[model samples]
Target chain A: MPNTLILSIDAMGGDHGPSVVIPAVDIAARQLGDVRFLLHGDQAQIEAELAKAPAARAASEIRHADKAIAMDEKPAQAMRRGKGSSVWNAVEAVKDGQAAAAVSAGNTGALMAISMLVLRMAEGIKRPAIVASWPTMNGISAVLDVGANVESDAEQLVEFAIMGAAFHHAVHGSTKPTVGLLNVGSEEQKGHEEVREAHALLRANSFDFDYRGFVEGNDIAKGTVDVIVTDGFTGNVALKTAEGLARFFGNELRATFKSGPLAMLGAVFASGALGAMRKRMDPGAVNGGPLLGLNGIVVKSHGGADAPGYAAAIRVAADLARSDFTAEIDRNIRRLGAVVSESAASPAEGAAE
Target chain B: MPNTLILSIDAMGGDHGPSVVIPAVDIAARQLGDVRFLLHGDQAQIEAELAKAPAARAASEIRHADKAIAMDEKPAQAMRRGKGSSVWNAVEAVKDGQAAAAVSAGNTGALMAISMLVLRMAEGIKRPAIVASWPTMNGISAVLDVGANVESDAEQLVEFAIMGAAFHHAVHGSTKPTVGLLNVGSEEQKGHEEVREAHALLRANSFDFDYRGFVEGNDIAKGTVDVIVTDGFTGNVALKTAEGLARFFGNELRATFKSGPLAMLGAVFASGALGAMRKRMDPGAVNGGPLLGLNGIVVKSHGGADAPGYAAAIRVAADLARSDFTAEIDRNIRRLGAVVSESAASPAEGAAE
Candidate 1:
């Protein structure tokens, strides 16, 4: 922790806890050199797992915690009684500047609540958004408000656009990431009030990011924009719907190959290509969702993710920690605040501004 | 018109127009026995196409219209000046009781606007919803408010539940379709005010449908319920997201098979099974979307759909017309009105009510 980047890990989080967390740290350590892990969990359990992974053991220091938050704990309950818990302490490390970012596989509600409480909102953000990397045909696009805020107004959606674009530029290294408001159609008159209002705001403002008006749901996979902005409810549904469909396609393909003798024989010859396709479609390849708008960085891994998947989350955390993500967000948010104030002064400026 | 079930065709509606519509009517004629077609469009063009399709020629009677609505025409503009248009007349046939339903391979906006204006709302519906058949692992499920009302209140969502369940029963023959309200999570406190309100309303009411608790996006493909009720915005996004993902999967699979000689050879061996799988995944197989809550039935086919797809739309309209769909909807809507009145009378009934 002398001069290296430190990442706080909730070792007792998720289903497998230290068993998966330790190995994940080992994997991430190889990829992310000069990074130290501040592990928060039961000392004996973590030490036992860390012993098996020499790479992780060399770069990790244990910060023992008395309790681990349950996966099914309500957000409010977790916030009220989760002090000194593994998840709480892991996020606390980030707040205390002992770690640049915190990575957790605990329940989303608990993690979001604890992270918000410990890290607090960035300068002007009312509600923090969870941004996920959406794998598209042309690489990955950033989709924000995945499940953080249930509903977002026009102002919040615009904030998401700014934050999402900054995150994309920081993590994915897009020079000038184009942002789009998710709507039913690209038409100006389409969609509901909030989306329409967001569209107006995005178009009116000369934000740092390129605003690409409105885009439909199909455009998410088409890679029409670098960042897709939407309310948490719609974004969450879109993300899960795509996941469900992908799984359905995989299940259907497997069942098709197993249906007949010819298909099975074909499967043998096509196994290499099919395996490549499976790899491309694998959720583990991009398993992290960064909780954006928080003062300190926090990356959340899927509860069911394997070591590689958890490592992916760790890498996302590392990317945000290394980049000027927080500063970029602050600059854009300040710009947004100015634009909003100007619009407020002038009634005829724009409907949403 | 004389004892035979009549379907009005918008001959000049879609991209292909009469070329697709005539053949579609011919194909539907063979399947839907004792059904007559009241064709509305350019009489000369429809006659030429109908001559090529003997089944359609025998069943259909041409009703010439001077104009056809442009595919890109705005809904308000279309409604203002589209009186004698083919789409207008096709819907008019339904209103006049000359046709059991109207099937159009037209622009959705124009169709929805024209249908609403001509047919008007049913006894109690404030806004009509567009219901689509979603292909699921367990047969097909009904998802509604696909793109009708972008912002639906709690009352509207409950209406979607009743209407969707009725439509599912009418067309798919589900005795009591299980209905689920689309939300971010299953928890009682999850999602926005509207979704939570809708969930409470659905849970409290004893509609004809079986009301399951709130469901997430993944449950859609898993076929957790027979019908999923959501606002047009979320439903539309979910539908298109799934479509985009499915298309992405298909494109990936095609690319995988074409990557190398061995993969191509494997594809050749697996062609039969793959073709079957392709059929299962085909959007054309489930092309039609019925605009529910209207006084008369109106089925809209995909604008780019071919003959088979248009035939599917016709079949949907026929199934809806032949059943007690309207009566069922009326009964359920009446019951809903009563329930709302009772809940309004009792202040402490439920949060949504």
Candidate 2:
């Protein structure tokens, strides 16, 4: 028999709350074996939905939570009065050792803030980062620090590199991912001081992953590297900008195909191929964005994710929990700390000698 | 008879040099009335290409230059040794008042460097910004500082807003353009100190355009504003990211349409609509990127632009020359100086009282 794994889920989060959560858990339960869920939400609502999903009812243990944080609530406000809330308890289960991982589809800012507070930063990590899976020409590459810290220094960027690579290995099954530092140009002297400094650091050390020097914004979709590391501000803008362009193109393409009867007939004949392309580009296919650099595993699904999308997020959480993701982070972060300290001590040690 | 406007051309620049430049001028001569060209390059090559285009030959005067800067040359190297190169002569014509504006499909760095060294910055402008005409759902919006300034202070960002707004008005014919500061979020306190400060300044001032406060990266293609002002670093990344995604989606769509026999037939029938959509998204259609904050106008076309694309850049230079772009900038910049000075003096005057 496979080892039984317990997963905590915030059933009162996201746009549809229990309605989406119960159905999503059912999908996840059907796909993943020997996995049990600790569902935290309103008992009546969760039970009403779980009754319709017999598999989900059999695998889930309900923990009644009367309070549910609003999707638009401020991070600080959520922190102050979020005790006993479904999202809060779901994360708490991971910290309490009752669950191997926690998954939630809720307010991004509040979820990140809560995850940081509950799990705390992993040893030697100054800041936490959110990592997104970007679909590329070759395959999916991981992009990190998407929106955790708006501003990051050289060391923080290095930390992101370490955590992002480890997370990619766990979720995407890359044994040793190749990482890249995002900049305006591929040249060493192209970007600002912090990026330059991070480049120097990444070049000096020999980590588990290969550190490709520098990559531009276009390199993200070109699949130039397995892990693309950047400060949260630039990464966030790039992510949202790509999403916006995709929407714009989709709308324009639809209008083009509907312009004339000939175009409409062409679209009908091309429906099979077009449907396949849409599936490849679908956001739901790769829905999970794991909050990296925290002490415990927590995945944040898109707030508007469907049942299948939420299930995809659950699979990500399960994969991360089964792998040595935390240990990998701890080892790399320790190496980084040593490198920084060694550089710091080199001049002083030379003087004494 | 219309008033004659002269445009200086870097005929020895870009991939095709005189062959593309002469044909492009021919196209422009047919489209725009009362526009004369001063071609700067090797006289023999310019004359050879001019033989094929009678309209351009009649309207053009060749100013032969012995040298041309290499596209990959460093900015400083070009500045040191680029005295009588084709790009240098092109800008010098504008500086000497022989040409109202200059156009180059050459080295962006060398051209910008030469333009800055020769024409110099405008009276109140600190640094020059390159403004790109971005294709949007509603129409085109002008995005500025795409790769000119790596980092911008709050004041420089405001300068971009003033220059960018004036530019949109000049080129796109927006009588009262709307401007937005590109930020991580629309919330007042979302971004870093500089963006926040820039937002505050834009909101406080009553300028020639309507200040739309802050816009995220996605708002660019959505046509949320007429002018989107950003620091060069963020703007460059965003521009490249969008272009990369566009290429990615285009490739995927083509692959989908060519996957099977039915799809191939559909592609044939829908070719007209697809061709029209392609034209809308073509980079050549909006090929010009004007270098703003200079004493005279200078537009940079894509290095690999064909004849028609090069002509588009020429048309942009012609439009700016005919419009009161410089005067509009001067009016708003003087107002900005007064506002900055007033704010700087308010506390001092109050303390003295």
lDDT of each candidate versus the true structure: 0.87, 0.86
User: Candidate 1 - CAPRI tier?
Assistant: medium
Could you give the C-alpha RMSD of every candidate to the true structure, in order shown?
A: 2.5, 4.4
Tens-digit per-residue lDDT, B1-353, candidate 2: 24799999999889889889999999999999988999999999999999999999999999999999998887788999999999999999999999999999888888988899999999999988988888889789988888887778888999999989988998899999999998777877687877877777776679999999989888988999999999888888888877777667778878988899999888887879977886686322589899999999999999888999999999899989999899989998888888787675222111000
lDDT of model 2 at position B238:
80
lDDT of 1 by residue, B1-353 (tens): 46689899899999999999999999999999899999999999999998899999989899999999998988888999889999999999999988899998879888999999999999899889999898888878999988887788888999999999989998888999999999888878677777777777777678888999898898888888999999998998888877777777778888999999999888988879987886686433488899999999999999988999899899999999999899988988888888788776322232210
- lDDT by residue (A1-353, candidate 2, tens digit) is 25899999999889988888899999999899999999999999999999999999999999999899999998888998888899999999999999999999989888888888888988899988899898887688898888887788888999999998998899898999999998888866677777878888888898989999888888887888999999888898888877777777777778888999999888888878877776575322478888988889999988988888899999999999999899988999889998998775222111000
For model 2, what is the alpha-carbon lDDT of residue B230? 90
What DockQ do you compute for every candidate structure? Answer: 0.59, 0.46
Query: To one decimal place, how large is model 1's interface RMSD in Å?
Result: 3.7
TM-score of chain A of each: 0.95, 0.95
- Model 1, position A37, has a per-residue lDDT of 96
**Per-residue lDDT of A1-353 in model 1, one digit per residue for the tens?**
46699999999888899999999999999999899999999999999998899999999999999999999998889999999999999999999989999999999989999999988998898888999898888788999888897788888999999889988998899989999999888877777777776777677778779998999888888889999999999998888877777777778888888988989888878979987786676433478889999989999999988999899999999989999888888888888888787776322232210
